[model samples]
Target: MTQPQGALLVGSIAFDDAERTMRTAATELGGLLRRIPDGEVGPRFHWIMFQPDVLGQAEGIERVGEERIPLRMLDARPLRVADGVDPREIRFPELGYARAARESYALFRRLREEGVIAPGMRFQVSLPTPLAVVGAFFPPEQRAAIEPAYREAMSREVEEILAAVPHEDLAVQWDLAVEFQIIEELPGGVAAWWDGAWAGVVERAAWGVDLVPHDVEVGLHLCYGDVAEKHFVEPRDAGNLVRFANAIADAARRVPAWVHLPVPIERDDDAFFSPLADLRLPEETELYLGLVHREDGAEGAQRRIAAAQRVVPRFGVATECGIGRAPAGTTEGILRTHAEVAAPW
Candidate 1:
């Protein structure tokens, strides 16, 4: 079997701080990782769940539901454009991504200088695609109206990150979780306001890829919703993932530096991996399968790896999503699983 090479952290480590996240990942995974993230700490520990609070800071927007959504909790209440307010006139405050990244990058730099983090590893900043934030927070009718403003705000966040972090040492990952929920038309998932689901998704993914200058490394983290450490919808196979990836490759200005896809814990069968045979990514674009589950540890990851090798001979490994929400005390073992399952790059 073709052995898995390297490892990718799909953002968010369970650590409480960036320092611990970086130091621990560097210590455990070491040479297996090409880049490391700031553990999506603070309000971002729950992925984009904190975005509603950020968006609510806008002058013309207000939370519409009766139940107050607590910070960092996954509540379904949506934000709405206030009466007599023009959605287009809404101006967002800092969306928090750039601010968090800037803060984390400082620690990353210090750690690297101290030789805690390796010299060559890039500091990774993962931002959700604007569509993710807009789609999740706004009603379908409000999405088209509010999306333009949010997209612009998100673009500016990307620009700020670019300016603050040096290109050579930076890597940006656009997280695309909600897009899959929309694509699969799963119940309770956000519906796309645009006409064609596939077109809308690819268009937004390409737009995000273009925002990062070619000099810096950028990648995509394609995902299904990761609520309570379970996929909103389990993929029957890798067909949709491969198709979406190929579409982004064809549509984007440049191929992504890497692309990650999730693997459910129950799937260690060849049928689940068979669709990877049709993946058309360029040789330069790396592929990482989120095959390492804390439940089964390295042993389960090895099973999934064996299945994947039958179709694609080369790839890397990751958890199905970020480890930030994994059950407590499992983070260290999960990191070690990646090291155990994959050869260091």
Candidate 2:
């Protein structure tokens, strides 16, 4: 297996300006990263929460909100299920991901020519899994019926991306916070709307791998839900992440090009990474451990690196989750921390 020598960005950079984000990432850490995101900017952080709006606009869905709870917890109904909505006949009124990615890649290409971004770095687009949308917006009973339509709509977004962007210069990542919610089944935590089974979640994610063309770089960001910049369930250890990642890798026909896992801020200890010893990834897959934290900086990253080395010989570094929702003014320091702990590619 090829060992990673640098850091990876888990998308959603804080920079609201797409062009500026690309410039900074390329000039500062281009060598360290093979992929760069469009920086889930402006409305994206909260856009997924408003997916009910999109579903409501669709022909066969109804958006109904809970009167008692906060406005974010929407309960979308599949009118088509009651009205015989064929999954193939269903189509979303809008596909946001494709539109955003196309806009960003234009900036990335311009930067590459301007000598800011290096040649051949793929544009990374992180997408919430269709299951995540189904789980977050619809009520438990409606999820099973709603998922097929949502998945088909999500597939259309991917299709549009592939048509617009070059396969060689594109990377698609399935952001997977909701899967962890299912895996852990936390008390009072967000519950999975599907048949709450570990294997089912893994299978769905692997099927997502199949959604992307094999030639396009495919990756998975295994995460605990990162709402308000905090994990829904802080991982007690890497065991669940290890188990889930291996399942996706095993089930995926086209092995993932990379898989990222989180590490708790305080877990710079052997016990946290011991499960990594059982991790079975394909030789070409890169493993990125999210161990770098702003609080500990370089010294803390070194501690996590040391602990991780005891179980797995080598891996790359990243922050535990996207830095966009983090406190303002901390993004640059966090980016620099990755540089401090690991060398550039």
Clashes of each: 0, 0
lDDT value, residue 203 of candidate 1: 97
lDDT of 2 at 175: 91
- lDDT of each prediction vs. the true structure? 0.90, 0.81
In candidate 1, what residue range of length 10 has the lowest lDDT sum?
69-78
Best by lDDT: 1
- Write down the lDDT that model 1 would get: 0.90
Scored against the true structure, residue 34 in model 1 reaches a CA lDDT of 95
Q: Candidate 1 — number of clashing residue pairs?
A: 0
Write down the TM-score of every candidate: 0.97, 0.91
Tens digits of per-residue lDDT, candidate 1, 98-187, equal 999889999999999999998889999999998988888787888899889999999899999999999999999999999998889988
* Model 2 C-alpha lDDT per residue in residues 131-228, reported as the tens digit of each score: 88877766676777678778888998999999989999999999988878878888865566546488789889998999998899999998886667
